[model samples]
Target: MTLELQGIGVSRGIAIGRAHILFHNQPDVREYLIPAFSIEQEVERLLDAIEQAKQQLKSIRNHIPANAPADVTSFIDTHILMLNDSSLTKVPVDMIRQRRCNAEWALQLQRDALINVFNEMDDPYLRTRRDDVDHVVNRIHRILADQEVADHEIADGRLKGHIIIAEDLTPADTVLMQHQGIAAFVTEHGGATSHTTILARSLGIPAIVGVESVRRYVQDNEPLIIDGEAGIMIAGADESTLKEYQQRRIAFDEHISSLSRYKSQPTRTRDGKTITLLANAELPEDITTISNAGAQGIGLYRTEFLYMNRLAPPEEEEQLAAYRDVVEGMNNQPVTIRTFDLGADKTVDGGRHLTQTVVTNPALGLRAIRLCLTQPAMFRTQLRAILRASAYGKIKIMFPMISTMHELLQARNLLEQCKLELDKEGMEYDRQVEIGAMIEIPASAVCAEMFARHVDFLSIGTNDLIQYTLAIDRIDDTVNYLYDPLHPAVLRLIHMTLEAGRKFNVPVSMCGEMAGDPRYTRLLLAMGLEHFSMHPNALLEIKQIINETDLSLLPANTLSIMEVSDALEADMLLEQINAPIIIKICLSFGFLIRTDKRILII
Candidate 1:
């Protein structure tokens, strides 16, 4: 009998083939003391394992095709650097000698310590780096434990034309699979924003993630079919099922190809209303994709990365260099840089310990602008760097998580101090740099008019706004289902912020997951949102929707959607108003649209 499974479909497409399982079990290392006489031998053994892991990473980096994409090579090179870095290799060796423990045990301890530091971080992108540390050390663990290191690339003649199944895949694993001619891949864990899924989309591979226990449910070599568009997986598929997916696979491919044509078109609604679509970025590597996606600007350049994965916070020069690279790349497009939003769960490496003792709930504790206001020195450092970089091109500064007028005043005061210092130092920066505030907190959203008077623009961070307004933790899967963006309370907050921006004549934008999603495109536009910032992958698709949409047809529909009390009812109203537009899109692209579920599969 066929066993069907559901997961979050991240990369869209379809795949049908035999299963190729990649077993990557964490090393089980129990702490035990070795004889003093064996201590030197253990240290040497640890060093040898480190050398072997370095060699393995070097080989993987070498295997990256000469003609492969720049990102693939960049990911492999990063792993090789980690293997050779003193922090990883040298630190573990020191632990082995000092603790008088086995090599596996020593490395395991170091991994935990490093992960602990990363876990306390507030940036989601930096938090995910803990997985990278795990993958690199797992390579050494395999060598130390005398376990076979499975081949990652498919060129070694293991399972050709097979769908890879794993508990989770790192960026390196995804890149290697692309080179291996793997048909598709399924993972038990990951999200749409994960680097693994991003790589899969870049490589144009079908992938499903967050399917718990998929690896254990299927035997090796079992025939499997993956519908990435629908997030469905069928094990031991029947002939009829296989035939249905084959047709879908073709249509999905054609639809994706058609989207590329929008790369050069302006994003304007059918009623001739121009829309500004910008890219939300975390890393410097993401900037190229932003331009490739034809974004008008970088809406949100998350600066938390400048404070992560290091012994201390990035120096002003270091931050300036990174910001400059993005500025030069955008070629006059506006780049809004948010201040280092540390505290909460995200802690800085070399910066001040703002939260010494763990707060029972860090989310409500010192974070974002609150932490920055309390620690003006740290805030000044970032402000100076951002001001210095602004001279290079169009740059704007945005403060995150501002909950009160006092916090905003304190932050602006320090920013002025940074500008004075820069002027004293004879540095060149744009004196007219635009300042903006992120209206995420309910308190701030309610008082947006007060904020608009002080800043040049307002960008609604809907992700946090919805989470806070609905009293749900977005990261907590249990309560995540209750996180509604369409709820009446959430809509009122958004509407209030936008209306305030309009009253003050300040540009209002949204830089959140909701802004990137096509499902809410018409709803947001009707609510008077003209600026949207999202992941680069969705830029073209959202633009396609914007270009075909007539803003004149949406206000009444949006009013009706907001008045509904039931969440499901609101969703149905949105689909009813939006479905015709989607259908037109599907017909234009010559693809079938299946609305059997929340996801519109083409």
Candidate 2:
């Protein structure tokens, strides 16, 4: 009998191969009283393990294929940096000595403390970072316990065509397995935003995550098929099932290949409505993919990376250089740089600038514009750097998480102040740089028209908009099911923002995950989203959907979806909106005929 399981598909593709169960289970750790003489010895053990873990990571980083995405190497670098941090290295050693405990137990204690801090973080992205701590600590525990590290090389090439089933995979493991030519992988744990998932998408590997207890249903070397788009894994399939999937796999590959034809083509709907497709970039290295994907320009260049994993926020010159690289790299393609969206809890200067008071919910507390306003000095530094970089290329400034008119005005005032400072210093910059605001908060969306009157453009950040509107943490598996982009309220907010843009004659764009998702491309287009910015990998596919869409037919259907209160009804309407033109026409005829019959009967 065939067995099937469902999971969240982070990447899009299909794979059929034999199962390769790769376990990276945490070693059971036990605390033991250490003799006074052995206290120093116990600390040395932890230091040695840390050194080994760092070496292993360095080796893996060195062996990473030159063709791999820059993010792959960056992930490894992060792990190595974590190992070097005093919290992981010196703090654990101190605990081992102070408590007179085994090295593994001390590390475990420190890991729990670190994870508690991350768990209390309200931002989903920051909360998920605790996984990195687990990954790094697990490696050290395994080493101190004399167990083999999980990221060991598969020298015999036996996993070349197999599907890996694991409890969870670290970024290093994903990168290594992909290098060995693994067909795909599925994990029993992970969310869509995990580093492993991000790496899977970047590596172009078909993967499914959050499949609970996947190992219980499958045996080693069992033939398996995984549909990454549908988030399904099938084992012990009948011949007919295998044959069907084989054909589907072929078609999927062909369709992906066909998307390349649209790389240079204009993004226009069937009715000749032109759309602007842009790429969201994190690092400067993303420029190559963004350009090759034929993005009109960088829609969202996130500046948070400059503040992350550092002791202090980047200096003006340092930030200018980094921003200049991307600005010049785009070769005059417009780049929209969003200011640092960091929270007070996520201080870049090692808690030197963080509030002493406990923030129960960092997401709702001081963050983004609020945090920037409180720290005017830091905000001005970034604004000055952005202004300086504008002289090098087409640059636009964007402020994140603006919830009220007051916040918007205050941010704009800071920008003006930065401009004046630069002028006094005789700095050459783009005085006409376009300024924009992000509509991610419900309040901001509701008051979008007021904001549109101020900014040059508006970008709907649906990721946070949906989360905040629904009052659920999307990264939380328990309530994440309630996180729906098609909810009546979410659509209404989006429509309000779009309508506001139209009323003020200002351009509106979407830079959230919704923009990259092809499933919502037509609905968004019908709702008047002419500008979309997403990951570079998703540009071509979204462009394909846009080219095939007929805007003339979508407005009525989209409006129907917007009017429906029930989510199910809205979903039904969305499907109709995305249906093929022929199918849609037939449905329209059928609806009209049914209405005529009802009228005659009445």
Candidate 3:
């Protein structure tokens, strides 16, 4: 009997192999009163465990293959830095001494506290960071419990052709398994944005996460098939099914290999329309990947990472250096640096200490432009740093979450103030540095024309726009189903923003997951989005889709989709828009076609 299970696919590909179950049960930790005399000894035990965890991560970092993505090393570096943070090290020791509790219990308590902070973060990407904290804390907990904290290694290439089934995976474990030549991995727990999942994508491995009780039915050594694109796992497959999947695997591999040709090719549509494809960057390490992907420029460079995991905000000089590195790395390519988008409840000392309030709904509470306005001093420091870096490269400043003209003006006013201060100090900077506004909120999307009048460009951030327009938490598993980018309301808002940009003669770009996704690439082009920015890994694939698209054939079909109220009907129309040239010609010629369960005649 063939059995199937569904999960969240984070990385795309196909894998067929026997199962390799890796059971990593977390050790139980209980609190008990400790004698005052042993308090120091208990604290010392925790310090030692913390030190061991750091060394282990360092060792893993050292062992990462040289051919691996640069971000791979950065992920391990994040874990090591978390281990060294005072919240994990000094805070736990203080808890042990103050509460006279066991080291394990103290560490567990601190872990819970840290996770709670992460859970309250408004950004889905930031919220998933709690998984990193959990991975780090669990390492120390295992060490304190005298258990093996390292992943068990098989010396004879036993795992080379095996599919790893696990409760979850840390970035380190994922790296080690990839090095050992695992075929793919499926986890019972993890989100799409977790560091482990991101690493899997970067390493070009087939991976699915958030499958429930996957190990319960998958026995060790059972033959299995994983479709990472569909988030499907199959067991007990017959010979015919195995043959079909083998053919699919070959075709998929060939398709991936063919994407490299688009790296140096121009992103022009079949009808001769040139599209500007850019890459969204986070850290300076991404510049190399962006360049290799042949991105025209950096469309969105998030600045929040500089303020994370630190007691104080980065001073002007440090930020200037980091921005300068990215600007220089791009070698004159335009870099749009978005101001920090931290929320009040975010786990950063600068944000929490300044806000000093427990926000019930951080999503709707103080964040992004609101937080920046509240902390003018911090905001000015960032503006000055950005201005200083503009002298080095083609830099643009973008403001995030600008819901109202008042907020936009307020932010722009501060930028003007920073410019005047730099001028007074005789600083060399770009006097005409372009400014843009991110249309992520419904209010901003509705009033985009007004924003366009004041800024050089408008970039739609569909991740937050869809979430806000649909009134759903994108990261909440229960409500996330309602988060739809294809929703009629969302499409209308996007269309309105694009129209507004056109009316003002301002360039419009999209910098969200939707921009990178191949499924909606044609639809977006028809809707008048000229610029697209996404992860560097997705650049080549998106460029390929753009090169094959014919803009002349899309507008009418896309307009029909926009007017449809039913999501299924819109999806069908979108499929027709993206169909192959033969199918499209048939549709245009009034041919009847049966696809799946639907029969349609044009």
TM-score order of candidates, best first? 3, 2, 1
User: How well does model 3 score by local distance difference test?
Assistant: 0.88
Per-residue accuracy of model 2 over 13-119 as CA lDDT, tens digit each: 88999999987767899988999999988888889999999998999898899977778898999999989887787877888778888898889998998787778
What TM-score, computed on C-alpha atoms, does each candidate reach?
0.92, 0.94, 0.95
Model with the higher lDDT, candidate 1 or 3: 3
In candidate 2, which residue pairs clash?
Answer: none
For model 1, state the Cα shift of residue 149 in Å: 2.7
Expressed as tens digits, the lDDT of each residue in 79-193 for candidate 3 is: 9998878888788899988999999998889889888888888899999999998999988888888886444433357688889999999999998888889999999988878
RMSD of 1: 2.7
Q: Which stretches of candidate 3 lie above 4 Å from their native place?
A: 149-156, 350-352, 581-602
Candidate 2, which segments miss by more than 4 Å at Cα?
A: 351-353, 581-602
Error of 2 at 375 (Å): 1.2
TM-score, structure 1 vs. true = 0.92
